[model samples]
Target: MDVLIVGGGLVGASLAIALERLDLRVGLLEATPPGALPAVFDERNLSFAEATVNALTALGVMQKLRAPTGAIARIHISRRGDFGRGLLEASRYGRDEFGRVVVARDFGEALEARLADATRLVRHRPMRFLGFAESGDDVRAVRVADADGERVLHARLVVAADGTRSAVRDALGIGVEEHDYEQTLFVTRVRGSRPPDGTAYERLTDHGPTALLPRGDRHYGLIHAVARDQADAVASLDEAAFLARAQETFGWRAGRFLSCGPRSTHPAIRVVARQAIAPRAVLVGNAAQTIHPIGAQGFNLGLRDALTLAELIADARTIDAGADCGSDTLLQRYAARRREDRERTIGFSDGLARLTANDAPLLRPLRSLGLFAVDRVASAQSFLVGGAMGYRGDVPALCREVRA
Candidate 1:
């Protein structure tokens, strides 16, 4: 096989699909069953940037979703006590919408359906990455355990899409640079009396970041961030109590929140791997870097990494039929190409996680002023909106390859 990808989550599955378009012999080993979805795709909401939508469209992954998808016509960002709110409208850029929102379960269903169609791709379910050793100077021998027992497979390259606590990364001795925000995020689906208006919200308060994302069924998705010490108390509240507290913190911008779905909590942290490329292995998705979810850039960045590597491999293959896809030269180029986006995105997310969570009295006015500037200044609005829409420096061709 030309490539063996470990971990068949969103990034890994998408990578497999992208590489298949290049006619590469690809093998995907997923620890779960053939059709079983990973835990990462729980009933949470995912905001896709325009760039992400383009890439997924090119990969033919966007058309398979069956659940309701909502468009974000505008994003309203404000501070709790601020008078001015920053609003980014799609009309400003001549775009129909800034992006789309879909439940992760719908996305997972689409991915599982796509995995059923394989022309030059092989998918192994209930299989895992045990470790690796030198098969030869040209390739690495990968060990995996399955129902039939452990076996070895040889491939020129292994892509780690195994998530933040990647077993593959751990096996490779790749160190991770991690940051704990000392906060926890509570995510729930909420309903308001008002109808859905295609607007997403991000409100910064003394508590933390509160996001009200629109869902297709006129329900608003809520992501409330609170200090870790207060998470348990918040999570244990009754539905009525929760809604009351949400209303108190979030205000009446979206109307009164009447009901909410089951709540889930996750600790906020930024995890960046010390190295993304090894001798014969490369890391993508959470395996590479796990950024704060503030800007919704995690999956977008991971998808870009996959597409860029796929494009590079295709270019190299055209010149030499037996090109070393995992050669040091190719890996070095991948690392270099990813440097600017990776650094800027990581720093962007890290900065947001810190700045917004700060409760300093002196900093409040400055932060509020920043929001006012983003609202009033066209250039400032463009810069912030550009990043939110995933138009960072040096956008790759694949992100611009959407057919529609």
Candidate 2:
């Protein structure tokens, strides 16, 4: 195997597809069998930046997705304190949309279909990775066990896409810096009287940042961040009571909230691994970093990780042909390429979360003024668009416009 990917979630599956596109032999080990996914789309709806959408489109997965679902053409961000509001419209940037929003399940299923069609990819289901040993010159042998028993699979590279609490990352003796915000994110889908009008809203309140992302059929994906202690009360509230509270916090931006689907909660934490790569091993997706959902950077950042690593691997193959490609030097180069973008994104998300989570009087005015200034400043708007598009530095070829 050229690359052994652990975990068959969205990130891992996408990584396999990306590598196979380069004509590389790839093997994926998944604890879950193929064609199995959660029944309904998770309450979460990921905001796909233009770069992410383009990358997925290039991979041929986007074509499988249902069309006319959820597209965010505008974004309205405001801090509830004294911070004034800032509105960003796609028209200003000469584009039709800032990004698109898709239900988690839909995106996963589409990627799974594409993976099924890739001839260079192999999948092992219901398998557990035991460990690995450095075998030949530049070959790492991995031990995996399934219902049939155990065996060793050797590969030039191993990618850990297992997720935030990554077992492979721990086996490599990598340490992560973790900050628990001590908050719980309550997520649900709400049907309202008025349509979203292609606008997403982020309201930073004293409790936490509440985001209402536009969804199909006059529904919105609602997320309210609150302290852990207060989560039970909010979750236990009746429909009317919950709607009232949501109305109070979010106002009538999408008109009155009529009903809500099942509610779910997740603890908020910001995690960054000290290192993303080791000799013969590279961590991608949540295994490398996990950020608070304040700006919807969690999955988008992971997608960027997958695409960046794919680009590196493709470049190495072009240069070395049949030679061993996954060396320490290759891993180092990949790390260097990713370091700045990772640091900048983590800092931006953490700073935003902390700043909005508080209600300090002095800080309120400053935030408001900053928002006002950004609205009037073209440079600032461009910076925001660049960041949102996942082009922090040395933009990847696939992220740029497809040339003739």
Candidate 3:
């Protein structure tokens, strides 16, 4: 196989689809049981930037989603007791929306739909990637096992999308920078007094940061952060008590909280791989970096990783003579190209998470002033809008709009 993609999730599957246009054979290995999706596809809400929506559309994944998506027409940002607020409205930006929100299962279904038509792609399900061996051609001999037994598959390059605790990443001795934020995220479907108005709310409270993302069926996806010690208490509350607590934290600006769906808890930890490229392997998606949900930047950044690498691979084969897809030069170029975007995104999300996760008395006034600048200062607002739209220094091909 020209490329062996591990973890047939969103990032890996999309990458495979993109590479099929090239003159190469591709193989994908999924660890989950046949007919079952990866564990990441759950009830969680995925807030995609405009840039991500464009990339997904170009890759044909968005056209294939089986579920409804909610457009974020406006975003309301505020602190619990601060009068200053930051508002981003679609109309002000000359677009219909800054982004869209979709459920994880729906996104997974879209990927599965695209994967179904990959007639030339090889698929190995219920398999595990044990390790790999260096080949004479400077490629990789990947060892994978299933119920029938084990086999070595040779590929020009190996892409690891296995996620945060990636087996391939571990085997490669890749170090990760990890942070235990001592906060747990509680997620659930919540309803307000009235139907959602195409608006999302990000409220920073003394407890932690809370967000209400507009969802289909006039409901909102609730992500509430709490101290590690209080997470159990929050999740154990009855529907009435839960709604009351949530409303108290978020206030009545969105309206009275009426009810909530079943709740789930996730311990928040940020993980970023020290390096993304090894011998003949590269990490994408959660395997490359995991950030807090403060700015909803995790998946968008991962998708960028896949798209960037796809372009690099396509260019090397078409533009260079005797091109080696997994050679030192190709991998080096990939690393250097991704460094700036990775660092800036990580720092941006980390700063937001840390700033909103705590209520420092001394910092309250300054935080309010910053939010004011975000709303009142044109330059500050433009900079933030650019970031929210996923516009960076090195733009991806699919995300760029053609000029008339």
Candidate 4:
């Protein structure tokens, strides 16, 4: 195989689909079986950037989605007890919407359906990656186990999309810089007294940030953040109580949250791989970096990582069919290409998470001024919209514009 992707989750599956048109052999190894539910695909609501929507649509994944997705026509950002606030309207930027909201489970199902039709992709499921070895200068010996037995698969390059606690990354001896936000995030669906008008609200508090993302089916997806110490109490709250508490924290911005669905909680943390590549292997998605969800940049950034890598690999193949896909030269180029976008995104997410959570009196003025600038300045608004739309660094061709 020219490339073997470990972890058939979102990023890995996306990479496989993106490379289907390329003249190269690709294999996807996933632990989950064909009919089993993937752990990464749950009831979480994901905010897809415009670029992500375009890329996925081009890959035919979006068209396969059976569930309806909501459009984010506007974004309202504010801090609790603060006078300054920022609003970004898609029309102001000459766009229909900033992005669309998707259910993670729905997205996974679409990816699965799309992968089933990929002619150039090979799948190995109900399989777990054991480790890998540098078998030859241009090949890697990867060990995987299934119900049958363990076997080795050789490939010129390996891509790790296994996630935050990636076994592939660990086996490659890559270290991560981690930060515990000391906050717990609760997500669920909620209906407000007022119907959604394509507006998404992000309410920042001293403890953490809370978001009400517009979702299809005329409901809003709620993301409630609280300190770790209070997580237990929040989790134990009944539906009515939870809705009441959420309303209190978020104020009446989108009208009172009338009803809410089941709640799910996740501990917030930031993880960044010290390096993105090592020899014949490379890391993508959460395996490369996991940032706070404040800006909803995690998956969007990961998709870009996968697309950029795919672009480079396709280019290499176009130039020389006999090229070593995992050559040091190729891996180094991938790292250099990803550095600017990766660092900028991580810094934005991490900095925003920490800045808004700090209650220092000095920070209040600074934060207010910053908000004021972003709201009042056209250039600031353009920059904000550009980032929100996933325009950074070297954008992939598929993500550069909507497909004709």
Candidate 5:
């Protein structure tokens, strides 16, 4: 096989699909069976950046979604006690929306549907990746197990998309830099008295942030953050109590939170792999970096990792049919190209998570000033908009194009 992907979740599946146009054979290993859903594809609502939606649409993944997606036409940012606020309208940039929102489960289904049509793609389902059996100069042998038993699969390149605690990464002897923010994020769907008008609200406070994203069904995706110690108490709250607490944290901006769906909690942590490549293997998505969810940049950033790697592989093969896809030069190029975007995005989300959580008296003035500048300054808004739309450094070909 030219390439073997170790995780058939969101990013892994995307990478496989992105390479479908190339004349190389590809394989995907999924631990879950054909009908079982992986934990990664849960009830979480994902905010797909403009570039991400465009790339997915180009790859024919978005067209297969069986559900509707909500558009983010406007963004509102503010602090709890600050009188100043920052607002951005997509129309100001001559676009109808900055991005779209979709449920993670639905997006996973769309990926599966698209993968079904990949003529050159092979799938190994209910398969478990044991470890690397042998690492040769041009190819690597990976040990995998299934109902039939254990066997070795050789591929010129191995891409790890298992997740944050990736076993594949561990076997590759890669170390990760981890930071626990000591915060818990609770996510669910809610109905506000005032229906969503395409505006997404992000209210930051001392504890954490309260975010409300518009949904397609006249509802909103709510994300409430609190100190880790209070997670149990928050999760145990009744529906009425939860709605009341959500309203209190978010204020009356979106009117009262009348109803809410099931609540889910996640720890706010940042994980970054020390390196993106090892021998003939590479890491993408959460395996490369699992960042805070403050800006909803996790999956979008991961998708970019997938698309960029796919683009590089395609270019290399085009230049030479027998080009070594797992060559040291190719891996170095991938690492060099991905560094800027990875660092900036991880820093952006980590900085926000820490900055907003810090209630230091002196920093309050600085925070207020920063918000003021972003609100009043054109350049500041442009920078924010650019990052929000996923136009950061070394973009892939598919993400560079936008259509109405």
Candidate 6:
């Protein structure tokens, strides 16, 4: 194999698909088998910008998603301390929708189905990575244990996409800097009497930042960031109490919260690996870095990594017919290309988490003012749109509109 991808989650699977399109031999190893979409409805939702939508569309997976779903036409941001209040409308930018929101299971299922159809991918499940040894300039031998037994697979490059607490990254002796926000996020789906009006809401409150993303039906995906100690109490709260608290902090934008689905909580933290690349290896997705989910940058950033790496491989193949698909030079180039965007995104998300978590009077006004300015300033608005849409640098072919 030219590349061995550790982790068969969204990032790894997406990377396999992207690389296979370039005629690269890729192997995907997963601890668990890919899951099927739930028969009943579930609440997990994803916020995909125009660029991400375009990328997935080019890959031919987006068309399989069930649509007429959630499309964010506007975004409303507000702070607890009345410093700035802002609203961004798609109409102002001559766009029909700022982003599209889809159910998480649907997205996962579609990607898995596509992978099953791709011929260049070798899928291994119920598998675990044992270790790896660098053989030469063009090879790294990896040992993996699966249902049958143990086997050795040699590949030119190893890409880690196993997620935040990646075992592959750890085995590679890659150091990481982790910042625990000491905050917990409560996520659930709630059906409301009123529609979302195609608007997403980000409200900074005393507890933390809460977001209400639109969903199919009359329900909305709710993520409430709160202190760790408060999470249990909030989670245990009755539906009425939870709704009351939600409404109290969120205001009356989406009317009233009626009932909620199963609520889940996750600790909020920012984790960045000390290095993204090693000899004959590279880390992508949460394996490289995991940020607080304040801005929904986690998955989008991972997708960018997958797309960029694929583009580099495609370019290399076009240059030399017999080129090593996972050359160290190519991995180095991919690392360098991704540094700026990764740093900027991590810094922005971490800063936003801290700024919103504070109750400082002075900072409040500044944040509010910044939001107002972003709303009023055309350039700022465009920048925000572009960033949210995942179009930071030279967009890859897959990220662009498919040429007819």
Query: What are the lDDT figures for the candidates, one per model?
Result: 0.86, 0.82, 0.85, 0.92, 0.91, 0.82
Please identify which of the two predictions, 2 or 6, would achieve the higher lDDT against the true structure. 2
Give per-model TM-scores: 0.97, 0.95, 0.96, 0.98, 0.98, 0.95
- lDDT by residue (160-266, candidate 2, tens digit) is 98888888898889999999988898888888888778898988887778899987657898998878889889888988898788888888778989998878888
- Give per-residue lDDT, candidate 3, residue 91: 87
Residue-level lDDT for 153 in candidate 6: 85
Residue runs of model 2 more than 4 Å from their true location after superposition: 38-41, 134-137
Error of 6 at 303 (Å): 0.2
Query: After superposition, which runs of candidate 4 have C-alpha atoms over 4 Å from their true positions?
Result: none
Better of 2 and 5 by TM-score: 5
Candidate 1 structure quality by residue, lDDT tens digits, 14-75: 99988887767899999898657888888788888888888887777888888778888999
Worst 10 residues of 6 by lDDT: 33-42
Q: In candidate 6, residue 126 scores what lDDT?
A: 69
Candidate 5 lDDT by residue in tens digits, 1-404? 99999999999999999998899889999999998767778778899999999999999999999988889999999999866889999999999999998888889999989998998999999999999985668898999999999999999999999999999999999999999989899989999899999999999988888999998878999999988999999889999999998898899988888899888899988999999999999999999999988888999999999998898888998899889888889999999999999999999999988998898888888888888988889999998999999999888889877754
Q: Against the true structure, what is every candidate's RMSD? A: 1.3, 1.9, 1.8, 1.0, 1.0, 2.3
Name the lDDT value of residue 396 in candidate 2.
59
Residue 24 of model 1 has an lDDT of 76
Q: Give the TM-score of candidate 5.
A: 0.98
RMSD of 2: 1.9
> In each prediction, how many residue pairs overlap at the backbone (N, C-alpha, C within less than 3 A)?
0, 1, 0, 0, 0, 1
